[model samples]
Target: MGQESLQAFQHQVGDVLLRHRSFLDVSSKYQESNGRVNRAITKAVTECGCLRIEAGCQPFEEAIALSEMKNRFDTHLTGHLCDHCLDTVKEELGKNLFYMTALCNLLDIKVEEVIEKESKKLSTLGIFNLR
Candidate 1:
């Protein structure tokens, strides 16, 4: 994405995070330890490109993006993930797919093309079998 589009996406993600903060906070309090939640948030933010380095320090945008993605993933996928189970993982993956599809639609991106490209990337990473 171009820089302007990327910034808009980040802002929209931030808004989504803000809208769901209360729910996320309450859910996280009961569902997992703070450390795990933090780790998950960090991972999601980094993966989403919400986190960026500026003068060797992270900015407010990164923090907001991290919080948003963390809440989104936790709310949607956390309970579905398990170390030894593929069924739950598959369900969660489906949820993620639906979410990204919706996001692409909202952003006016081509959902099918993006999904095809992202599916290839995920398949290459061996994260999941999209086939």
Candidate 2:
């Protein structure tokens, strides 16, 4: 609700993302696009998160497996995934959710809060208005 909180959250998210994606921290230089790094983290979180939710995988492994699976898929795909693309296009929403969580963590927010807020906005304003 507060601008300061939002800004703080954004900063934390940026820091985490940069640290995770920074070429300096990486060994192989992945040769992937910025999109891939984003996607990797996102898919790892979502798919892995889901798996954990269903008791299919542990919280830690869920994300890691998703990243690994995505990499494999990306590598096997037609284009040279080895080129080190960001892989963002493969899972746009996945990346978005990661950023969202990063912001939530920064702002000390709960996913339930965001869901409720958006639900109220949608019901009152309508999706077309994006209100």
Candidate 3:
């Protein structure tokens, strides 16, 4: 597609992402419900094209669960569960944001505006603290 078409497509997709809240916010929702977490992970993996899924391997949900389990085990080995959890969450957030902003850049979109608007929406919902 031409740059103009790609930019428009990015804006449209960015709107949908904002409406669903940022991928990071959705990842946080895992504490509230695993279903939401799985769905969010699936969407992230599919949309961001970060993780490669083999044709006949485990599904996305299984892969996410396995990855989480590995993270938990690794963190537990460090003997600082609470700190590890917080750090892991932050890492996941950063990773998601990085991939998303990269995608926006590839599409010629302004990621900062999308992030600012989404952060405001989440703050108003009392779910995320940007400060």
- Write model 1 residue lDDT over 1-131, tens digit each, in one string: 56566556545544564433454453443244434445544444444433432233222354555425434332222332233344433544544443453455445566446656876887786523322
TM-score of 1: 0.27
Per-residue lDDT value at 71 in model 1: 40
Q: Candidate 2 — which residues are off by over 4 angstroms? A: 1-90, 127-131
Scored by lDDT, the top model is 3
Candidate 3 error regions (>4 Å): 1-81, 116-131
Question: Which pairs clash (backbone N, Cα, C closer than 3 Å) in model 3?
Answer: none
Per-model TM values vs. the true structure:
0.27, 0.31, 0.30
lDDT tens digits, residue span 1-131, model 2: 46566556556555666555533333223323345656554454455432111223323344554435533332212322221233433555445556555546545676556877987887877634421
In candidate 3, what are the lDDT values of residues 54-122, reduced to their tens digit? 443322354544325433332112122244344544566555554554456445657656766876887
Candidate lDDT (C-alpha), each? 0.45, 0.48, 0.49
Candidate number of the best TM-score: 2
Worst 10 residues of 2 by lDDT: 74-83
Span of 10 residues, lowest total lDDT, candidate 3: 72-81
RMSD in order of candidates: 17.5, 16.4, 16.7
Error of 2 at 81 (Å): 18
- Displacement of residue 1 (Cα, Å) in model 3 is 33
